[model samples]
Target chain A: DPVTGVFRGVIAGCGYFSRHHLEAWRRIEGVEITATCDSDPARARAAGLAAYTSADQMLEKERPHFLDLVTRPETHLELIRTAASRGVAVICQKPLAPVWGEAVEILRIARSAGIRLMAHENWRWQPWYREAARLIRQGAIGQPHAYCLRMRHHEGRGDDPFPAQPYFRDMPRFLVYEILIHHLDTARFLFGEIETVCAELARLNPAMRGEDRAVITVRHQSGLTGVIDGHTLHPSASGVALGDAWFEGGNGRLALDPNGNLWTERGCVWRNDVAAGYRGDSVRAAQAHFIECLRSGAPFETDIEEYLRSMAAMEACYLSAERKAIVSPLKFLVDSQSE
Target chain B: DPVTGVFRGVIAGCGYFSRHHLEAWRRIEGVEITATCDSDPARARAAGLAAYTSADQMLEKERPHFLDLVTRPETHLELIRTAASRGVAVICQKPLAPVWGEAVEILRIARSAGIRLMAHENWRWQPWYREAARLIRQGAIGQPHAYCLRMRHHEGRGDDPFPAQPYFRDMPRFLVYEILIHHLDTARFLFGEIETVCAELARLNPAMRGEDRAVITVRHQSGLTGVIDGHTLHPSASGVALGDAWFEGGNGRLALDPNGNLWTERGCVWRNDVAAGYRGDSVRAAQAHFIECLRSGAPFETDIEEYLRSMAAMEACYLSAERKAIVSPLKFLVDSQSE
Candidate 1:
């Protein structure tokens, strides 16, 4: 197997974002995407692989070495269970699960199964953030004290807001749960552990059940303070690619424009150059990391534990908004552990 | 006095900001600055007017029609009472008093004396905000649903953070009380009364007694949600001058750059060419309004009642930060009224 080790991979869920994952898996060398499964047969057929209605059917039929669960948060638990039962390594899409208990259960299943599991949180892998982290590490911005990410998309306007994902309007816990979770994980990746989160959420669009706008103040364990200001109701100042971000420190500020350029006001010279693929080929990078870790028997960068931390942070943000107080992400983790 | 209507005004407390007030008063027609007072005789003398060590001495000897109390918040009550006793109209600087009870007492004193009083809340008079308000009124950005102002100055870093105002290090309450109070009043001036406020405060600078950074989420009575994210420690995304802001509505967004240019992306075109003087010569405009009101028997725009509301908002912001909950500024007003 080692002499001719070409691992077979199968994708579960062929939704809007899954296409990126599919493309990425195909690009990663020595990885063959055996088949794709989606609840919607049409979407499964759209993947252009051996199609299956159920992940169990695909896992049994293909016996793929790995399962790429690109499904929604709700379906992740069952799909991960199926993958684990089939003794297949799995890379699941975030938030891992919809709630804290389910996320813990997912972690538990992965641990018991002893299968290689990775949470596909690709925002941090976005070349700009990686470059930002490198800059910070290089002492470009001396002792980074603050960071802010403002993500505003024009899609949450007009009659048909969120055209790609219409279900975004219907989710009770949108914004923070659906999107800012990526930012929260990315924040952790860039700024280290989060100590506390105080958030204010608003539902600007009448048709949406959940909050369309959110401003979350994050206090890192390292004493760094930052804000994640995001909304779907309006376009961002930088014209809404992934919005804009800035990392401020002792020297100066490192800014990420909408077009994915990471340049500083002065001194620090770093550029992302707007690479090809999705968000600087972050999906490809994320998938490649999973495959490399599996081949080398190395731990995942976003393992179940790290993903749980990000998930807890998201939970804390929602709780802070509801309670009108600062919430510690650690409390959720500790609570879940006790339970 | 009605024939010429040349009102003689004297300045009390010749501090750092008081210079702008003095300059503004000098520029105003039909208003002559007869004298200036400060406990520090040197500061009073620097005004190049008839100087005195005490406001009482200045008020009695100058017999001015109005007193511009440019002193600090703690000194406001005594100076205002002195002006009231002399039956002199007073235009006091913001935070009418440091505490709620003192501010209410100042209001009561003004009411009982039946003297003309105004709060020098000059930020709303800033040419950009004025243009922004006009644009909103003209439906440039449609019904405004959200606003965010981020003010970051480079002064709150290193050993001596606030060089201009060295006393900033000593203030028990900073940021929101000293600076963002202007933005809160400006928000009221632009988008009606604030229904609730939730804030997260941090002290990034080690030497400062108070929080140097804050992110205050404001929910206006008109359902407009906004944030005032400010810090003294870092330079803003735009340059240091007033940071940047955006008012988002049904149509698009109205953006205000650091250089005082207010413009929309596609349709609307409203601009504020940076004018001379302090923050669009707002101090001059505020003084002009006060002087015009004095001459025409008209009410002051930032009269005692309106000033009290801004004070209440300031109080609520502090309380919200302390209690870790959303607070209504109206409660402070009600509590004061009952007393």
Candidate 2:
């Protein structure tokens, strides 16, 4: 560690969610978040780390072992390229890219340069989801055949979510890209890679330019049919409740109510009172996983190569909605990869 | 009402559900259920009407002006033809035939014989659904853009819904044909006729011969996307709660809980306590509507010709699921009708 007692990391994009990432990195025993960078100096300063307005400046000065990208997807490619060239392992946020082709190319470039890359797919690491997956693997639900997550965060109701994240009101790719991607990636973690995607999207909120609601049906390779049903304009019982979800198998069903409780068809309920603390649960777990992988040379759970499957599913959802059809996501992704 | 003070009707197939039909028929004014016929003499006798072992013998002896066919889909075509040829207006149970081709031919035969025909697609006529449709038309939820009915009757469990209706366990096409067709019809009733269908089916109930669970996505002519998600193996809060449903438009959302409670996005709850009555409130309304049309020469709500819209959607669901593609039900039905 160059006589340094701890592993080093730099985080870019001091947005609304970066606090969780920085806090998470800080919580990890072996790591220190050396610097936090954002385009806006105020946001950088707000993070309370050694702040830099330019990510390149932070990377040059801190020379961190890893770069944590909590920025918008538009900036991820440049950050990944900028960091990977300096032999920095990279962890970018969900979606990975604005589109699948670009994500594929970005990963290809990173891999060719021998850089360890991972997507910050945190939903799979969410405390409740982690417990749910554990039970699922233990056959609590007996071979999961169907999974559904109904998303109705109601953030787009008026100016609520828009106030915290103003760019959401104008993004061309909103619901599925900015939000539902987490659920889709979680579906992959719980169910496996998706095969086909049949989707229908609606712009429920007139103020937003892109779709705020969508119903995406995904058929997993394991014969598991998963649906990511969403309505950003509708509120749940509580504001924190993202959605109600269930994974059904032959013998029983595993359900997650909007209130963050995991329940089973057989009448067992689990609550995750142990919040992830400053890092947030999944963000903490995801960053911890990346750090461990960096140190021990262990394979990442959401390595860019594997994370591309969820991205491919996301890409297919858009295509399916556009074409009004069920398109095979895995087949399309695999074919594109071959090309 | 030929000054006789009675509207005579003969009902065929005295299965378990027929008792509800007979009870509701008794409640209707000016109606005399002259005969109840079944292939089995005991079943006919159990119906407690002027019993007959054969429908043809009952028709010849009683000379009823209308026939209600409550038999299985396999027998639907023959019974429809038998009654229609005698110039009797007919009310037949749904899944008019075993397949789309046969259903098409049966309707064609009825039309050729100049006899009126209607499918007993009663879900649309349910009290809550009717109210929902009325409110939707009145713009309670604004533009009526999306619809979803998640079916979780759990009736297909081991031997629960089997002992009474053994045929369901044996039917080659169960859920979508016998059940989801009702919701698809309801979608049309609430929104408009469907233009395209994208679907996926699963046979969760190993005991059942056909798929007991399905997700049928229908795009209506009005640009409304409706999902009839069926799963006969999953239980809801109660056994009687058919499915949870919602119809979303630009302004708000209209939802029906797994129980009978119907509500709006504005938080107004509605419960249809009057219930559909013995024959199923919808079945009663459907029959009453049929009788009114017979008396006043008005067109039937689910008249075979127009009702084919829903049947087409159901047919397309099978095709879409089988082919893993979206299909035009209207185009398919119209082309089949022309053929």
Candidate 3:
């Protein structure tokens, strides 16, 4: 047994997040996925673990130490609450909830139960992001007055119905909350608490109910203002043809020099270097960090508190989008608390 | 005599526009600068021609055949109308007038007088932009379902007050009218007439009065949408660097692909390539084309009517920004006509 006594786990959602977690856990020593549960029985069985139809059955039978909540955002609150009640630490994917109130409740419940909660805000752990943070700390870009972070690609409509989940489809503002929060968390992790947020949201791609595009401006507590523009709807060259899908799919570039000067230039060119690890495989490294934190009670680099603050920023972005005005995080958090 | 008889010309203003025009006209075979007029007498003489205290004196004495109006937006209407009444074929730099009504009046007077009124919308003549247009037309990027155009650089502020004019200090929407019009024209030139425009304007740099940044979404007649982001506030970098200053600074990379792709990569990795004839010295080629058109009495590649339509679309962008609602260019133009 490891120091935390073997953390037997079950992945209850077998989607993209689940695939990443399952693969990472398999590589970590002393961690065992004793069972797997999914709505799709076939997918659950294919994982080579004892298959279960539901999370309740898996929790009741396996008595796992941890439950990796890779399910949809709507299912997240219930899963975390259940895990807390059963004294099972929860490692859930963001958004913590579809709405802010639900996210707060999940955090509150986990706190009362004294069970650890980790939101998989993995962009903070991505190699380039980590390098950016390191360079900024080293003063590479000279006090870092402004940053323009963008994640856009020409994504063809996938046959999978996962992206069109009800909680996702109906909420136009949640696209910023669900998708761009990774970049937001990345901003916070590199800079600090955001002071004010002003944003504009639009649904360019009519197929999705949510805003497929957003341009958000954030003023950090350090007086640094950063703009994040995200779109999953832009047209891009195919990854397979480029042989470097991660770097070449989108027309943007972010680099951190050895002297800590962080530079980002977009709308010029796209070149992918496979060897540099620009791909979105940093989730595996993030999973490893979570496991280490779970075993040693060492605070994770991106903890629940940090994720909650990022959530606060996300909620502020939605409010700014709603009111069509600039919103301060402090005022937003206070108002939400009153509500 | 270069076929079109020698024309005594008075350059109405002395700034960046005047500098470029003087350089181009000096090289032309037919025209000669008889007098120079500017609000500032010091600059008038320094601009390499006989100084005139005012346009009235310059026009009365020199009786110039052509007037190049490169003054501020507020003074454009008066300068253009005065020049047109004298049957002087006018070449004016853009934001032809501060307001659309004024612009229409200027256009009307020029047409009534049977004088040529060229907007000097030089972006259409920019080699790189023209090359991008050609490639898209040639199906290099395969129909270009979407385009992301960005124009940003770091040098809008400087210690020298002369470079930053007085009108420039308070012009509330320079990006939309001046800079973005270039990209907007490029989009329309490459794509087609924009049907609807949705935009978000922000004053990211507090030092600048006008919104220094804007993200505009244009829905073209062809069902293709384009996102054009313009900023005069981004810190100086190699890729999006502006003008002769960038070439002088020497901070970017220029390479040649044996296959005729003239590649320039900035931010260390983003590569953009255009076919050989369309690369570096293509600005001179564009100028040469303009001169050839003038000599042959042939229509210029970028027609004034087409440029006016692009200006109409740009006006829609400002309306969308102010109204905080999607503005339709086709509707706006029709409504203006009806009114």
Candidate 4:
């Protein structure tokens, strides 16, 4: 018997992103990822744990402390029900539901079951942004007036989706939901909850089902404006800068360069030492946070209800583009109750 | 009687910015500053030339080949009319009038008199943007889908406009019409004429008469969207980067840093050598373009009719903010005649 309440776990889904989940779980102290399951037999075996093609079988046999869910959105509701039926905790990856309402429903079910559910929103866990937010609260930049994050990359030009994430070819709610939700969440995490989301989306690449180019603007409760942008078609031979940002405040400015250096107006260049940690350090940090919250009775930073703001923001972005008008995410959430 | 047809000229308004005009004019080989005029005696005399407090006295007495009116908008129509009545060629500064209609009226007077007119919109002449535009046309970036320029400064925090020009404190349309108009023209210079201009403005600074922050988005005829931003409250300790831009095309990216360097996705860092010429190289560039157009009977790039596009775009930005809706410049121009 594991008398320490060692928190044995099983992580489902072995896609390319699943490797980070497995690696992160191994690094957390007092946690053992006792088994791994994937529909693909080879992927399941490759995780170097007790492999199973059946998630139900793994849950029945392992009876772990948590079920780490890293699967696609379509499989999320069924998996969540499966886990909740057994009364286990869950730390799931995002696009928790391709449909925003479905995500809300999933959260409602999990909360009713009294399970500790943490969505894998790791952008806020990234060191540079965390430090930027810390300094902003410390008046390093004063009251932020404008914020921008550019997440342009070159991995989306093919006629079909790239090999790594082959399913992306048909992600109808692509950039804003799949990739840009992280930025939207980060903005909310750094700034306060947004008041309105106004976005203009463009589908520049023929290969993708949804828009690949986005210019999303948000107004925060603090009367500041922000932009989260992606230009996948924007060519870059060498500057593989992702999530580069410039946050403007009343007294000073803090900008994050692609290379993890934060430039401030006070002539300080704080190299993001946190980002310099081992390859999966943010994942490790996130996992640690989840475990700590689970053990100590502290709430998860990206708990079911808390992470919904990000999820609502993502939906607002799509609706903003769809309607060609600014959509107030909070208002949308409130209005959806009547619907 | 310098026989090089040394286009003798009188420059009006020897205010703070007039020095750049005078310095640039002096650097141009065939132009001679016959006189300098300012409403303030001290300002006029400060310009190392035959000085007069009244522009009328200078134009009547000097009878130079051209007149440069660099004074405030309130005096532009009278000055341009004064010069045009004599059929002398003239170059005037921007905000041709506080009202867009008045600007159009002034241009009509100049055109009817056949006076060669150029607005001293110097930003496009800046070496870095000039080169960036050149490269974009040369297929450096495959086909621009997005562009952004950040024009932020600490000049707008106080009730009294800073030392150089105190009148900015009283200007009713500050950022968009005064500062961002250059960006509007530059966007047209780099991309095609804008089809729609959308802007959201805020009066973040309590002391200013007009908006201190603006987020203006434009859709170019080429199916690209661009943003021009100003956040006065955003703090920056030392990066006095002005007109910093990131232009994204299908194949590559072009960025201009405040330090006069253009970064290309091709891994080339082309130092903008033109910026090294003199304090007023861009002014000189604008003046040179004016003279070349005057001498060659070539129309000005910012000629009255062509320049109306910039003026119209500026009007659209203001109306967009006022209406909280996208305003088409050309459509607004057509609609304004009815108003």
For each of the candidates, the C-alpha root-mean-square deviation to the true structure, in angstroms, is: 2.5, 3.0, 7.4, 3.5
Query: Which tens-of-lDDT digit does each residue in B1-339 have in candidate 1?
Result: 467779998988888899898877777888889898888989889978899998898888999899988888899888888889889999988867888999999999999988999999998998888988998998887878778887877778878977889999999999999999998998899999988888778888889999888888888888778888888767433352478888888776788888777778774365565566788889999999998888888988799988888888889989987887778898999999899
On TM-score, the leading prediction is 1
Error of 3 at B225 (Å): 4.5
Candidate 3 per-residue lDDT, tens place, A69-95, comes to: 888788988878788889988788887
| Candidate 2, residue A16: lDDT | 88
TM-scores of the candidates, chain A only: 0.96, 0.94, 0.84, 0.94
RMSD of 1: 2.5
Q: Which stretches of candidate 3 lie over 4 Å from their true place?
A: A1-5, A15-17, A40-42, A95-114, A150-181, A192-281, A292-338, B1-8, B29-33, B40-51, B61-64, B98-101, B108-115, B152-154, B157-178, B194-339
lDDT of 4 by residue, A187-290 (tens): 88898888877777778878888888888777777778777877666454323236488887777778888766789756656775454333226777888899
Lowest summed lDDT over 10 consecutive residues: which window, candidate 4 chain A?
A: A234-243
Candidate 3, residues B36-120, lDDT tens digits: the string is: 8888999898876789768877887888766777788789888877887777766677777787777767767777887766666
Stretches of candidate 1 above 4 Å error? A1-3, A235-240, A267-275, B235-240, B266-275
Tell me the spans in candidate 2 whose CA falls farther than 4 Å from its real position: A2-5, A45-48, A157-161, A235-238, A265-268, A274-280, B135-146, B159-161, B235-238, B247-254, B263-268, B272-280
Please give, for residues A121-223, the per-residue lDDT of candidate 1 as tens digits.
Answer: 8888888788888888988878776678888777787677789999988999999998899899989998899998887788888878898888888888987
Clash numbers, per candidate:
0, 1, 5, 7
Q: What share of the true interface contacts does each candidate keep?
A: 0.36, 0.18, 0.00, 0.34
lDDT (10s digit) by residue, model 2, range A1-339: 658657888889988888878877778998988888888999899877899988899999998888889998877888888887898889998768887777878887798889999898887777788889899999888877677777766568764457778898898988888888888888888877787889878776678998887888888777767678886655333334476788887678888876678897557568757654531276788888888888789999899998888887887888888877788777657776797
lDDT of 4 by residue, B121-200 (tens): 88888877778888999988877888898886765665554446777766778889888998899899999898877677
Cα TM-score per model: 0.94, 0.91, 0.73, 0.89
Question: By lDDT, who's the top model here?
Answer: 1
Candidate 2 global Cα RMSD: 3.0
